[model samples]
Target: MQFAGWLGMFAASTAVLAGCNGTDAADQSVAASQLAADECPSEGVALQVLGSGGPIAEAARAGTSYLLWIDGEPRLLIDAGAGSFLRFAEAGGNLATLDAILLTHLHADHAGDLAGILNSGGFEGRTDPLPVIGPDAAPRFPGTSEFLERLMSKEGGAFAYNGGYLDGTENKPLLRARDITTADGSGEASVLDISDDFSVTAHPVNHGVVPALGYVIEAGGKSVVITGDQSAASTLFAERLAATRPAILFAHHVINGEQGQPRGLHRTPSEIGELAGVMEPDQLVLTHNMNRSLSRIDDSRAAIGESYSGNISVAADLDCYPF
Candidate 1:
């Protein structure tokens, strides 16, 4: 989709921006109670699906978002989609503790909640600059830094009032949006960040005409690979992460290879299975669920099970999978 159309649709679909402080005491208490019941375990390294649904609205799930919890803190975030603002709060995500934000692509379902997330983080008193890494610009897409400037630039941005993030002069912290080279065959995977706890690498992937990326996060002696929306035609992703042997592989399950489906934009069930067979992740988690794919989940499982004999799971919003 074109950038303008995506932005318009996202603006219409997303809820009004209301920070955590907007809630009343009783509402906060009830939310906290619910969070306690549905939150991920705080003792180990795990991935919490803050939004498991795709671009389309699904009452049971949110859009594509994830939070990586290490020990007890929310360390990293991936894809802050439309409804993830509330899910992030429910998952006990604290920007004060979060290390960075990694975006696969600038699609509405993948990054619509970015401004909301950054604006909400101000409430937590985060002063440190946060890195927002994403794919470089393509024909119809804006680069990571340009995307942020268009949204938060002080002079003329969609949310000009929130321009503090660009320079760190206002009450909010600085947000550094770095564009990673996503050209195929660009040497090895791009190492985005590394720290004492975890290291992250960005792998280039083909998502039709859009510049896209897949991520490999290594922490706690385990590896997790998140295959952002991509076609099955390319083997670069599999070839790059062949040795990683991820503990969990979160592959996008957006379409069935039906006759009229967009084969260049997404993987079919058979394609997912093929990648799983090669990667040999300990667990294969099918995420980015859309209505069409969800309707024929049995078929998807059957197809994937042919090549992959390991565990397969269909992710749901708020579901936590430990490594």
Candidate 2:
């Protein structure tokens, strides 16, 4: 089939020249399709990248967010970063059926669209309470509950008016924010949520002093671990996640080992490669790729590939993968 030009751009963009330190372009031609309209894989759990970019706004990519399609429904949304709602709209996901949202952190680029999502849902014809989960209050960060209160509470939340959706008659969103708190330094995996077919677990990951979390979404005999925007300064997190035997690791980091450079609490590629080597996941998808990683995709993949023999895929908005 002739590829659509936009898809060609997407496929081409994801490719890291194989000769560039042995990086592979193996999957580029499989399905070069528009991210906004791509269909989820029909079986197992399918994850679609809604926004693949990060903190800095970029015309070519939205912020960090993902949609999980289960039983053919886009029911779970992971992270609601800036402009994520637009991506969600373009992707044809039904807002009314969204089950829950898992926020890896409260960073503007990670959970910035929380209110936007709730506000938009106010018009999506949903009556059931929407669940929003995030980490507990840290020194400088507000927990999920506090954040929701400040956003939807009449007592000064910026969007208190949107809270009315929780009680409105039709086409309104009812929201419930759940905060997961594990004492800092505890590498224990805390259960954020559990269901018949799947469960979501979180553990602590180092991101400077911020109380951050890394999540594992387990379903259909498959596990996908998202390492939030964390550094691999410690081995506890990697060990905790490896125990899950993940099929995929959506690592949000890039390699910048130079000192005096602002690495912004993210891990370097070699660190990620080391972790992936131990986890031995079938695939290691490097995401939250910044300008550095974008310009040197092959280096990032090659650095990671040095230790991990698994397939390495650079994620782009709308790319879909099923477990």
Q: For this target, which candidate reaches the highest TM-score against the unseen true structure?
A: 1
Whole-model alpha-carbon lDDT for candidate 1: 0.80
- Write model 1 residue lDDT over 215-316, tens digit each, in one string: 888887899999999887557888777756789999999886444277888888888998999999999999998778988999999988888999998887
- Clash count for candidate 2 is 2
TM-scores vs. true structure, each candidate: 0.86, 0.84
**Cα lDDT over the full model 2:** 0.72
Using lDDT as the measure, which candidate wins?
A: 1
Error of 2 at 192 (Å): 3.0
